[model samples]
Target: MVRSDSAGNGGDAMKEHCGVLAIYSMENRPVAERIVKGLAALQHRGQESWGIAVPGEPILKGLGLIGQGADANAKKILSFTSNRGIGHVRYSTRGRTTLENAHPLDIRGEFAIAQNGTIANTEDLESVVEKEFPILGSTTDTKLAGYRLLQHYRAEHDWTRAFHKLSKELSGSYSFVMITHDGEVLAARDEAGYRPLCLGYDPDTDTHIVASESCALTALHADLVRDVQPGELVSLTKDGLKITKFAAASRHYHCPFEYTYFGHPSSKIDDHYVYNARRKLGRVLARKYPFKADVVIPVPDSARPAALGYSEESGIPMEEGLMKDRYRRKGSLRSFIEPTAKSREEIVREIITIKPVVDGKDVIVVDDSIVRGTSSRNIVQSLRDAGAKKVYMVVTFPPIRHPCYMGIDFPTREELLANKADGETLNVTDLNSKVAREIGVDGLGYNDINGLSEGIGLGKDEMCFACVTGEYLGLKKDPVLRTREEMKA
Candidate 1:
């Protein structure tokens, strides 16, 4: 368990939810090693803690990166031969980052479950479960949900029926994978589809694979079947694959942030490849905000494709103005995990080295989005110090004003840049000016909500922009921004 008494800085950007993977092998073989490889590909989604659960074997889990987290106990589960298994890589959003809160949480040693997304009514559901099962250990929603499922299974005696009943009582975002005591693998997504989940098939061994992103399937050489539809339940056994509609998709709010930042560039979500979607966002930004600059530079990894699209559309030459120290990538995680302010700034400075290409040249910087404006501010200051004549900031997503309630980490308005703007009414130009002034940039431009829809090739109704427009789809009440103190209470 990695315990920290320090509270985090306000400017830290949104964090991703957990990544889930489950495999059902037709041949009688252990799948824990393959699960590790697939999880390695999805490691970007989480870094705090990870776990793998094989039925009839002691779970393997620990804190920190996957390789560093697992110890000798890992081999006990890895060597155990099981036809079915489930794995999870987690970055805590709802609970403390500790071994006790890690995934593959078992429900009375009957079912093992791993989940991505926050359960909005976690406490209420826990209260409901305590009426029957009095003993509970962890504070994570995965544990609460698992106990609820166990309660349903005991009464209904059917997995599908139990899942259907569980679906009606739950709210908020979730994409879950589970392994039963008898070697059955099950998966499902919430009604609104605020998170991503998909199914795939392996041809070599005729195994079935399910994961949070399509990239995980690609990592294992599996062919993607389709995205598990919102409110759908999927089960895999030695017999075959069975999918059932547990609940109708009331309002589909596939997270737009997945394309903007969270998801891998190569992964496809809801029929759109994230890399192409980001490139389209850049093209739209260039057309909307035409800036005169000698060169364009991306903020690195996530913003690279968008910068390429901006350069192509604006006819401005794109250059690598900053060389990211590949070895320093691990240090970047400290910016998000460390609770102190000074450590965050120091990590940002160590990650990217300024190149002389932008010296005496007007530079245009393309970034995915600005959450707290910390990274963008640091990048802008670095550019100015490197002799860049002027710096202009172009963002792919619209200004985020409200906090996200689904599964994103920035759940409070105090951590948002657009919250600094003057009125409740959303004013793009006003918000842009305020953000530019705060980040110490000469000018700033953001994609409009409509433009984001057009670029991503989805209608405004098909995707969730609640963080930017404050139009929630499935939530009951307006999301309140709670401080860390309030969260502790």
Candidate 2:
């Protein structure tokens, strides 16, 4: 569910690394402007920085929220014309946050690439790329992958073959969109479908669009086409959409967190509607956790659907006990992906606690997942200050014990709350008790992996539960299957 750069992963809260948007104007009309709209729709995936790459121009990139902040020229510069382009919104996991690392990473004039998901084994990839396609300034794995793409293309001459080679060379989750010097836009989903990437069409503009989520397509008034299949490479050009099954892992490992947390509620990932899946998660939580609370309060925005299902299933009235202070400067920020402790703190401050609803009541708070436990502690403290008689926590997803190496923000194993001081992951009951005590909650319940799979209508094997289960699937070319010791180290 997270979209953070596999490179800049350090913050406590889980982050969606990057959102990719690609638009190819069938009529060859200016699409640079539409790319901005699509990226804005996908901004939640990443907010630290954004950039767009189109042919015949240097990639336009900026640090911090797109078209805003100290980058005074962003708004105007993003308006530059191009009939087709690829755009990216980035949140780092393995690299520093700066314009130099902003994506749509490219080589001289051959191609540019923007991606969602982690290329966990970038160090090994360096031998294949670093010297020839050297990156400038601060580095992120994405910049390296960009050059690697070109390196493969150089040898293969055919992009489809190059992408297939890259698929074999790559060792983690990824969904990529790239633009060629000739304005060709191509999208490739990793072999396992580890991150979401889909296609859409806007009849009005006659544009072929690709984005991390279908929600971006909705923003462009585009019709949802099928998801770009796992191991599929789709090209959008004058010939329309050309799909090739460049590679396929033996099994698929779709990220479950998308349905639980990161994905836009209105979007569709594969065959499942994200909103419905979340509601099912809430219903499952209510059935299993069965809290006799006076009110069920959702951690704003992302958890709203799950909370609603919890309230409806439990017959406990759902109250808007907490709402984002939209008028506040940081109100729109998703706490988990804010990047900085200060920004994340501001997010906690932006929560408008409806004291009247929590006062003198036994309240059950529902949330997507607990990654670091910092936010949970602060949220519960706020409710206590609001006079909540008893506060219980119900989490939609299971406890996250291991760190995600696939484009998720929790790259360091020690940062996870479900682990011991020495970095040993805890069992469900022990983890629940420990997290509840640490967060000052009376009770806590986390969905187990099975419950989570059932709720999302997916079998355990169908999704990537590596962060929860410590079972990495489909990361190829000798995937770095870190042992507990190495993870802690």
Candidate 3:
């Protein structure tokens, strides 16, 4: 396996996108403080900006990490005295990385919404809004969706009805935590459950928590309530919890990337332990792409569990082929606060140390996913320089070809390695082959889509495989979709 030289040496880390945390106090206790704490735990998900919206008060937000002075903003927000609030920590993957794009986007009367997925048909949606409701600010599709909903809700004057209408019109993946002015906290998962949203309980305070991961609830000593089922709308109000179903029923395609990369190791999604799922994926890969190697070296952190499972399944010893320097800073200190491609490359080069054991050995590298092939290419080059005799790469997920509108940040089609080349040029017959050649590897393998779905204990129909297969299940062709199709044509 290839290694990122910058694993342990702490320059800057590759960060995932935004995390959403919402809390509604059943007993009307001070909820803002709890929301702040929960967002702190989820800061690993997104680090660029943080915001919180409390009823009857102005939304509070700013640039930078959640802990670094974000607590002060939370404390300030706590002064609002609202029992229902939605908080967001953003990592700008699509829109401009600016304060305007920071979330917990509030509309005056209808609602305030925080979202975790990217809107793939944003260009189309934006056109509809510009012609229909032209007063909206910010470039994010999230804000556009919020305004569209606000417009619908103002006319309908019913939260559930407005949401149903908006869901029908929206395209792409989104798990939303929305707060209505009527003091209702509504949580809706995307039709395919592409982004994670779980429910939990704070027994002592009798509060209800909804977050992108279970780990946030655990940090606040909350009990696991349940995962918000796909295509389900959960409403929490002073009355109680209520569920409303919408959209055409289809199989849930939960994002496989969650388990392989984005999800926290301690979290559980769709009832399966995330870390355990990765290990199972590794085990499945070993069975499907068996290779005789002297050592199984994980790509580090994200790939560790799969590597362990691979070693156990292949009867190969797992060795730490790459040593991470925990203390070194790679580039400009400011870049760590806001990571870029240049910063990430520098971090990768600075963080890893090669082990003597891999110098003369045949090695198998296990990784979560390969997006553009650049990171994997760098890792492979680093390993070759470290004296590995042979390097084989294995990915836990299939090649990603399509851009994700439901929130996973994949490059556009033209930039995807699989989309750009045929089997011969890519070197392998499948995803594994394309990745292997891109990174200059002797052999490459990827877990088939079925293998991945089954390894996670989910049936093919129960998970969102859109990113893997480009087949959207519940998406409807509304005005936005139609207009976008016309524009493209």
Candidate 4:
């Protein structure tokens, strides 16, 4: 287990939840190898710790990148002869970044559990257990939820019934996968579907896989069967998959941020291709906030597709005006998830401004979204230093005016630029101008809520715009941001 005494702030922008994967092999073959691959593919969702659990063996877990973390137990984990097991890679939205808070947590030696998304009512979930069970102290929210389910399983002696009980009582978002001591795999998505979970199959190995994204499934060469429906539970055995709906999805509240920035462009979520959605987002921005520029540029990496769409729609040639310092070991790391302002700045500074492309040109820089204006400020200043005549910003997602509790980190309103405006009542135009000034850009235009929905090609009501609209669909009650000291008490 990896231990850290303290962790930095979760960057200056939006950080996401963990990634989860479960695999079952009919032939009882070594599944860890494939699970590792799938988890590696999903590593962008998390970088703190990686864990895997199989029946009749002690679960293996490590900290940092999966490849380096798994070095010591590589052979042992790789040789595990198990037919079914669950794996997780974590980027904590709850608790501290410590081994004790890692996922695939063992539950009373009878089961192991891991999940994606926050349990807004995690404190309340603990009430069902007997006092003798001890308070779920010094553990993450995942453990709180798992223990809650354990109480039900102990009474009913059935995973299905336990899940039914959990789904009914639990609040907030999750896509849970658990490994039973009996070597069966169970997967579920919360009713609101604030997170993505998909079912995939590997025909050659006769394996059933459940993962957080289609990219991970594609990495394993597994065919994506479909996304697990909201409020649905799937039980996987050698026989096949058994699906049960524990609740009704009267209205689905999928996260729009997934398509805009959090999701891998190659992945598909909720029946929409992420890459296509991103292109549409750029086109929408071009149409809504048409600006004449000598050339178009993207903020590297995630914004590349959006930049392409902007160029196509505006008839302006797109150029790689910014390039990541790929040669450096830390250069390729994502700045948005760096966990500290200093660290995020270090990574963002590594993004070199391609002077030849933007020098003396009126540049339109396309980005996925602006969280607190930290990285955007850095990028815009770099363009000025590189002799760019003008820099205009186009963001795919709307201004994140409200903190997100369902998932997609940045839990406090104070850290949000839109929310931090002089007053809370400024409209989009004034808010954009204020933010543009803060970020040192000539001008800025943000995709509105309606534009965001249209870009993703999903109905506004069917998506969670809570981060922008402040209307939560999955929260049972208004969430309170608890202090760590208070939580420890």
Candidate 5:
């Protein structure tokens, strides 16, 4: 997610969003250790906290890396020996990063839920839930969802009916996985399809895996199945996979950012490969804004594919000019994790060490996106510090000029560099010039929105370009749907 306030090791340039995973095996085998491994693979989604919930065992959750906490306590989780479970890694787009805000949140110990995306009407819903239920343990939207589901189940002892009622009352992006006391795993995505969830099968163990990314299924050696259709629910039972549509929409607005930066490159969402899309984005950007540079260097891991595509298309030599330090504490581990304009500048100063590869050369620095401009600015400054003659910036995605209300953490327009002109989205060239001046770069170019959509091989109607275009699909026009400013008010 595009969190500007959170900081991390090299203060993370942006939030990693959240990851959700679940498994239901016909063999009735213990899945705690496997779930731990899957969570470790998905650590990039969110590092603030990790958690899991099985039918019979106590919920395992805590702050920090998943391997350190959940994996160490795998034995305790295995005592339940249930065949079905669900897990989540969170970065807190809605609530504070605390143990209470962790996912797989229990509902009176009857049902547990892990979800990605925000409920736009959280304040109103929270108020309603407070009157019917006990005071909530935490203020997270996901916890609220669990309680709301509880209210529905008690009124009508049917899970599907409860979910249908819940869907009607909530508005916004969500991909949810819920596990009941009966060992059934039910996964659903919101009508808009803003976040991702997919269903995969493991024939070897006769298991069905429902997760936020196909990469999680791949990590567990499961074959790729189609994505969980938007507004549809999939139930994994001993009787097999049951699919139903709880809500209906004429279109699906998949988050384009998923293909650009949010997803693991190995995962396929909606049949589009993320790595290929990024590489194609670079190719498109190079064609649109060709630069005369001696070499191209990536910002590191996430930008590597785009950098390679740029080098391939532009015929510039690609070099690894900066090194990423892998052993850094991420998420809400320290105060630095709460980023400010100053902290973002300091993070790039420490996290990436510059090599002499670009010395005496006009270098092109390729990054996936420029959220707040502080990290990009620091990167350009670092290159200058390393004796680079000139630095040009090539950003793959268009400028994020609007705060994402769906799920990404850039909740305020002021936090976005491109949205700084009294809430105006600047022209592409104007935005680039402004960012270039701030980052100390000789020149800057960004992929146009059309170019980005084309590179991802999807039409504008299929993806959520809300961050770039200042338009929110599937959102109701209401006062309760908040940006950071509204929330403060």
Candidate 6:
């Protein structure tokens, strides 16, 4: 429903959910610039709007890239002298794209919150507030949650107790970082573990960092500490880090897509290399769904590593099928930003170009995942028009059936193609049978969930598969959207 006219063709140009970065320094050293650079390392996750929360000052946020210009906003943020700070880059999933929805959301006298996942029960929570406290701003569920936290703290006057109480009542996936007026920095991960959060430390400076991925820490020359366990709350203060368990810890469900697409290449997730995991996915796809192809071509950035693995395992030559314009602005143009469906179709054509090596030969196209099937459809059609003898579509991960509430910009069941079809009928069963009926290829295949986890060197129990499995780990109630059908009066 949201539309824009710009056309984005870069590798990292797609929609990301959000990214969070927080730092606690023991030496009171200047870290705003370092924080900004560290966030630049995580810019791949979200680019729509960015903000930094500094102690004893107003939160700084605006619409632009992090490492650009010497403007007032940048000067204001860089000038802030704080030993502790939090930064956020957001991609709107629950709320509209506006300055109000931008994170590091502050409740004047109470707390400033920066979040990285969707609050699934936002509507229900908002309903509770509409019936209880006086409403403040827009209909965004994020602000609603912030208000609830503030209201709870005001009544209880205990930050820890209020956080625990509110965590119990909220439903959906979220990893939150909050700074209280009392100078305590609190971080909490969702029980489902739908999103990734980790802690790292710079022993040299005695500074601790929390970010969406391990790569950010590496960029800041910080040592990798343990991941923030699900259902656990970590508080960073002058006395050092103190962790407390709130809700019963659920089975860890690290989103499988993180390795395949979202995470940076150099990053290590759950002790596994993201690039290596993707390559293993390719290898698994080749073994599970072996297809005779003359050459393997990746869909672009996210699929490149996996495609190489497929080529290595299958002994097929890998070719650079599509070229990306790296200079493209991060948030300026996007495939989904096309104003109309026809324009969206045309934008894909202008962006991708097939190599001449595929002419009169079978081609295997590897992509990270397919949500609505529109992008895949167009890619296949373009490859066919390039004179390929046959086009086979291979996705690195299994079909994404359930909408992701933990973050990743996948909202509403109506937009998911897998949700409409049963598992048995999916391409993995009869690749040719389904591909003949579907657009863009003679066959389509995907890596099995188990195979993907194995390839990543982790067990299903350790990673988040809720987007693929629909089995949320911790919350007792379903998301507000899912419960809407049953809520009818």
Model 5, which residues run further than 4 Å from truth? 1-17, 327-347, 421-425, 478-489
What is candidate 6's CA lDDT for residue 155?
Answer: 85
TM-score of 6: 0.87
**What lDDT does model 1 reach?**
0.78
Task: Output the TM-score of candidate 2.
Answer: 0.92
Give model 5's TM-score versus the native structure.
0.91
- Among the numbered candidates, top TM-score falls to 4
lDDT of 3 at 331: 26
In candidate 1, which residue pairs get closer than 3 Å at backbone N, Cα or C atoms, i.e. clash?
none
Clashes of 4: 0
Model 3, 1-489: lDDT tens per residue? Answer: 101111121111111257898888888887877788899878767777887877776667777777764555545664767888888888754333655556776654557777888665565666766677565432556777777777777789866687778777777678888887767888887766778889998889888899989999989999988998877788898987788775544566677778888787789988998889988898999998899889999876678899999998999998877644556764212122234567556656664747586887889999887766666778788888888889998889877765555666553565466655543234335556655777799898877778788677777777766556666664554213222223223
Model 6, position 282: C-alpha lDDT score: 92
Q: Tens-digit lDDT track for model 1 on 318-371?
A: 888865565765454534433334645766676564657788989999998887
Computed on alpha carbons, the lDDT of every model, listed in order, comes to 0.78, 0.81, 0.72, 0.81, 0.76, 0.72
Instruction: Summarize candidate 2's per-residue lDDT along 1-489 as a digit string, tens digits.
Output: 102222431222122368999999988788877888888888889988888887777777778877573246555555566788889998875334766567776655677788898887877777767677444332456666766787888899888898888877778888889888776789999889889999999888889999999999998999998898899998987888788989977789999999988899999997799999988899999999998889999999889999999988999999899989988888988988866566777898889889999999999999998888878888999999999999999999888877888887776666677764222446677777888888899999999888888888978888988887676755665456455445434
lDDT of 5 by residue, 226-336 (tens): 998888889888898899888877788888888877788898988899999989888898898798999999886678899999999999989999765555632122111
Which segments of model 1 are wrong by more than 4 Å? 1-16, 70-74, 329-346, 476-481
Error of 3 at 430 (Å): 5.9
2 versus 3: better lDDT goes to: 2
lDDT of 2 at 297: 94
TM-score of 1: 0.92
Which of candidates 1 and 5 is the stronger one according to lDDT?
A: 1
Could you tell me every candidate's TM-score relative to the true structure?
Answer: 0.92, 0.92, 0.86, 0.94, 0.91, 0.87
**Model 5 Cα displacement at 221 (Å)?**
0.5
Alpha carbon lDDT at 118, candidate 4: 81
Q: How many backbone clashes does candidate 2 have?
A: 16
Q: Write the per-residue lDDT of candidate 6 for residues 1-489, one digit (tens) a residue.
A: 111111211121112357888888888887777778788888777766777777777766765456552154676766877888788877654323555556677764467778887666665666666666554523445556777877788789866677677888777667888777766778888766767888899999999898889999999999988888777788888999888876655466677878888888788876778999999899998998799999999977788899999999999999987655455432133444232346445546554556596778899989888776677787787777778889887888787777666676665565666655454345566533454345557888867778888788888777767667776664557654543233211
